[model samples]
Target: MTSQGHVNNVIYNRLAESGRVNWTRNLAQFSDPKYQQEWFDLMSPKSIGLILASIRTDFKFPMTFPDRVTVLHKLVTKPDYSSDRFYLEAVMYSEQQRRPAAKCFEDIVVYDYRAAKKAPLKPFMVDELQATYDLQEQRKEEAEKKVAELQTFVQQVEDSAGAA
Candidate 1:
């Protein structure tokens, strides 16, 4: 049973390695602070909505709020990111955008929690994080190998137990 956190970590690493986290290409336009804020605001609603929609059930959203907050905090604090101010504003804008649907989307706390933890972002820091991810992937492979070996040993033990 893979936990959701593990799955998300894997997805994030894959995206980073593949250069899918290409913040530079889109964010290059944000050389100006004003433009950066606009871009952040635009991306915020879509990002939040997409994240919310990704929840498997309505209940999971509340349960994951803490983790969401942590990620947002990282986003805001990480010096690698370029447009922290805009990201914060964008998250605020997204919260406002959903005001009309407050009744249906009662879990606005999740968004608020996330926004409050907003860390400055490192647009296109994928290359910077690549080594870190490579180490993680290496560790994952080693763990898998160990698990496979353990499984083989367990099966052998079980087979001997049955034979005896």
Candidate 2:
């Protein structure tokens, strides 16, 4: 990674394309809609054209879930109310055309608030408590056996000593 945490891929001969720069930076930056728009602006048509060429050169994807989510984040600028309906309609149309990211997009993307919540405790505590109780019961049984052995030895000593 460079000083900006961009992954350095100098050997790959992409002619120093900008999409690679955007991609190498953490995709988590697109969690903010404003940041998503900023990245879209940075992705001029020339850069996008170059990126498509580079991707052809690089053999990139059928991308993984996170990759697809990041690509979607890059593609969607926050639409103004007037444009939003058209944008949504285009997205719906593209989905019908078998755009690959549609299904996994929701799966890959998580809201910060949802991710930040505490994880639920599982039900294993009851089983652990039962195991501890069983161990204590076994110890008590061993203790009782020890006490009985001591009692029998004392009785034998008293009997033998009295007989003597």
Candidate 3:
């Protein structure tokens, strides 16, 4: 769901649009051929049910259309084995202001459409998600290492200049 604004309704719509786009893009990565076919198979099933259990949104800034914005989404929790639920957090950043315009948290459930009930998330699904999270963490560490190396190089150059 979206929070409403007094000026225009576009912001609410934009939030929903951005959230869907982010979810779709992130989930689509698992469909690549290199990933296990199980992930793709689970996602391709027509009977697989997805439901939004809840959405909490906080609007920190007012946004209007015609302005550029960036939306970021991250999985906040792994799927609960017992409950078959997962959580996702999302943020909308205002490009012009360089600050977050809104933040949202969503609770989602996996349902078995054929049985008409909630179902446990398959083990393969959980594994694939964990792998994705690990990849992201690895990239973050690599970037931090590069930054630290650059900082060390700069410090050495400064110290040599002082000794000269």
Candidate 2 residue pairs in clash (backbone atoms < 3 Å): none
Ranking by TM-score: 3, 1, 2
Pick by lDDT: which candidate is best? 3
How close to the true structure is residue 39 of candidate 1, measured as C-alpha lDDT? 41
Per-prediction CA RMSD (Å): 16.1, 25.8, 5.1
- lDDT per residue as tens, model 3, 98-164: 8988887878777777788888776656766666667767887999999999999999999999999
Which stretch of 10 consecutive residues in model 1 shows the poorest summed lDDT?
100-109
lDDT of 2 at 14: 29
Order the candidate numbers by lDDT, best to worst. 3, 1, 2
Residue-wise C-alpha lDDT for candidate 1, range 27-105, written one tens digit per residue: 4353545445434443345322112222111112222112221111012121333333321101111132232110111
Give lDDT: candidate 1, residue 146: 100
Q: Which stretches of candidate 1 lie over 4 Å from their true place?
A: 1-124
- As for lDDT, the candidate ahead, 1 or 3, is 3
Candidate lDDT (C-alpha), each: 0.33, 0.32, 0.67
**CA deviation > 4 Å runs, candidate 3:** 1-18, 32-45, 80-83, 139-164
